[model samples]
Target: MPPTPATAIAVDDLVVDRGGQPVLRSVSTRIAAGSVTGLLGPSGSGKTTFIRAVVGTQKVRSGTVEVLGHPAGSKPLRSRVAYVTQDASIYRDLSVKANVAYFAALYGRSRSEAMAAIERVGMGDHAHNLAGNLSGGQKTRTSLACALVIEPEVLVLDEPTVGLDPVIREELWDQFRALAKQGATLLVSSHVMDEADRCDRLLLLREGRFIADDTPADLRAATGTANLEAAFLHLIRELEKAN
Candidate 1:
C-alpha cells in the first residue's frame, strides 16, 4: 500500500453529561487532513463540551472520540492534536515569547526554533510584552501561537475570534486558511454566522445534538435561504415544531 488515508478526527455517537444532564447525545462527525470544519452554534449549545471531549479533557459518557486516528486521551494522539480553548490560556506575568516557549517545552520543541512559531502568528513584535498587557486580539494570537508551536496535525479551537475586532478576525481567518493549505485539519467553534460561512462544512448544534451538517452554501441552497443565520434559524424552528 502506498499510504493509508489519515483521519484527523472522528467522533461517533459521543454522549457527555454536564451537571447530571446530557450535553452531547450521540453526536458524531469526522475531520480529515487539509480541511476546515466549523462547529457553529450559540453559547450553551454544547459546542465547548464537544470540543473538550474530543481533546480528552471531558470524559465521554458513551460512544467514541478519536483524535489523530487514536482514541481520545491517548498519549501518542495527544501529541499530534492541539486544542485552543475559548479562554486564551496564557500566563499574564510571562512575556509573549516566553509563554510560547513554555508551551513548546512541554511539547519538547527546541528553544532555538520556538520563536519561529511565535513569528508565524505575527506576535514577534510583542514578544517581550507581558501577556496580560496585550490586547484581546493579541492574546488570542498568542494563545494560537502556543497551540501551534508543536505543529499539530489536528487543530481544534473553541471560539478563537470571540473578542477580536473585525480587522483582526479577518486576519485570523486568513491564517486559518493558510493552515488548511498546509494540510492541517481545523475544527473551530463559533457563534458568528459570517465566520461559519468561511468553513468547508458546518456542524450546527443545539441542545447537545447536531442539527445540520453541510457546506454553508449547500445549507442555504437546501433551505432556500440567502445566509447561514437565517438558515440556522429556519432549521431550529423546524426542529422545534417537530417535537
Candidate 2:
C-alpha cells in the first residue's frame, strides 16, 4: 500500500470565542501536506477568525491547532509558515521592490527571488513604483510577493485576490497550483464559490462550522448540484430542513 499523506495542519475540536460569543464550534479537520485547500465562506462567517487560530494569533476557548506536527505559532514553525493577511501591509514610502526586498533580507533571501516573486505576481512593471502610488490590487500583489519570497513550506492566505482583475486572478491561481506542486501546503480563503473548482480540497464554512469538507467533485456528486454555488445552496436547504 502506498504511504499515507502527512497532515500539514490538524485542528481538533477547535472552539474559538470572541467578545464572549462562540466563533468556532468543535471544528475538526485535517489539511494534507503539499496540497491546496480552499476555505470558503461569506463575510462574518468566521473565516478570518479560523485563519487566525491556525496561525496561532487568536486565542481559542477550547481545542488545539497543530501545524507541521508542532503546536501552531511555535517558534520553529515561524520560519516554515507564511501568512498573507487580507489587509495588504507595505510601507507607503517604499517602492514595491524595496518592500519585498526588505522582507527577503529578513530571511536572507536573495534579490533574485524577490524579483521572481514580483514577476510571479505580475507586478514586475510596477516594481519601481512607490507602494503609495499603487492601486489596491497592486498593493495586494506586493503583499503576496513578500510572502512568496520566503518560500515557506506552508502558506495561509486570506482573500488574496479580492481586488485583482480576472486575468490577474487566474494567473495567481495558477501560481498557487505551482506552489502546491512544489510541495507547499496552501490554505486560501475566498467567498467566491466559483473558485472552488481551482482547489484540490474545499472546506465550506458557515457560522463558524464546516458545512462540507470534501473535493469539489465529491461535493457536487453528494449534493447532486451542477456547480459549487448550487451545491452550497442545496446543502443549506438540507441543513434548514434538518433543523
Candidate 3:
C-alpha cells in the first residue's frame, strides 16, 4: 500500500448534449496526477465530448468537471491546463518556430522554452519550415510544441498521433511518458486500440457511456483477451448481453 496518487482531474455524473441529442451520459472518473490516461473508443463514441468537458470547452447538461483542483475551464486554471484538438490549432502561414514562439508569448513564456518544446516533439529540424509546407504529422507535432511551451500541469490531447508514422508515434509516446515523469498529467484520446497499452490507465467508452475504467493489464485479464482490441470487443459483447 503505497500512497494513492493525487487526483489531477475529477468528473462526477457528467452529462452532455449536442444538437438535441445526448452525447455523454452520466460519465464519471478520476485521473491521477502525473500519469498518462487514455480515452479509448470508436469514432462518434463521445470520446471527444468527454475530453471537451474535461478541458472546460464542452457545454455540459449536468454534473461537474474539476481540473487541477479548480473547476474545469476556470480562469485560474487557464494557464495550468493545455489542450490540443484533433485538428491542428496552428498558424499554417507561420514557421514551426514562429507558431511555438507565438503561443509561448501568449503564456508569457520565453523563446528558449518554445524551442525546448519543439525539440521535445521531435520537430526541431523543421522549426524554420513553414507549417503549411509540412506534412500532416509535422503539423500535429507543431501544434503539440505550442501546447508544451506553457509547461502545463495538465495536458489534454485529442488523437495526437493519428497521422504520424510508427517511428514518430513511438517518439511522441516516449515524450508523453517523459512529461508524466516530470509531474504533468496527460489525458490523451485515441481510437487506435493498440495505443491502449501505452497508457497507465484507460477509460473505455462507447455510445456516450463508459464501459471500463482500469489499467490496461487489468482490462485484458478481466476480459481474458490477448490484447486491448479483443478486450474492447469482449466488453461490448458482454454489454450487449446485459442490455
Q: lDDT tens digits, residues 116-179, model 3?
A: 9999898989999999999998999999999989989999999999989999899899989999
The lowest-lDDT stretch of 10 consecutive residues in candidate 2 is: 1-10
Task: Give the poorly placed runs of model 2, Cα more than 4 Å off.
Answer: 1-5
Whole-model Cα lDDT of every candidate shown, in order = 0.87, 0.93, 0.93
| Candidate 2: Cα lDDT at 105 | 90
Q: Model 1, which residues run further than 4 Å from truth?
A: 1-6
| lDDT sort, best first | 3, 2, 1
Q: How accurate is candidate 1 locally (lDDT)?
A: 0.87
| Candidate 1's TM-score | 0.94
Query: Highest lDDT among the candidates is held by which one?
Result: 3
Candidate 3 runs further than 4 Å off: 1-5
lDDT per residue (tens digit) for residues 1-243 in model 2: 122358899998899989998889889899999899999988988899999988999999999899988889999999899999998988999999999999999889999999999998989999999999999999999999999999999999999999789999999999999999999999999999888899999999999899999999999999998999999999989999999
TM-score of each: 0.94, 0.96, 0.96
Encode model 1's per-residue lDDT on 209-231: one tens digit a residue: 89998988999998889999999
Instruction: Look at candidate 3 and tell me the lDDT of residue 43.
Output: 98
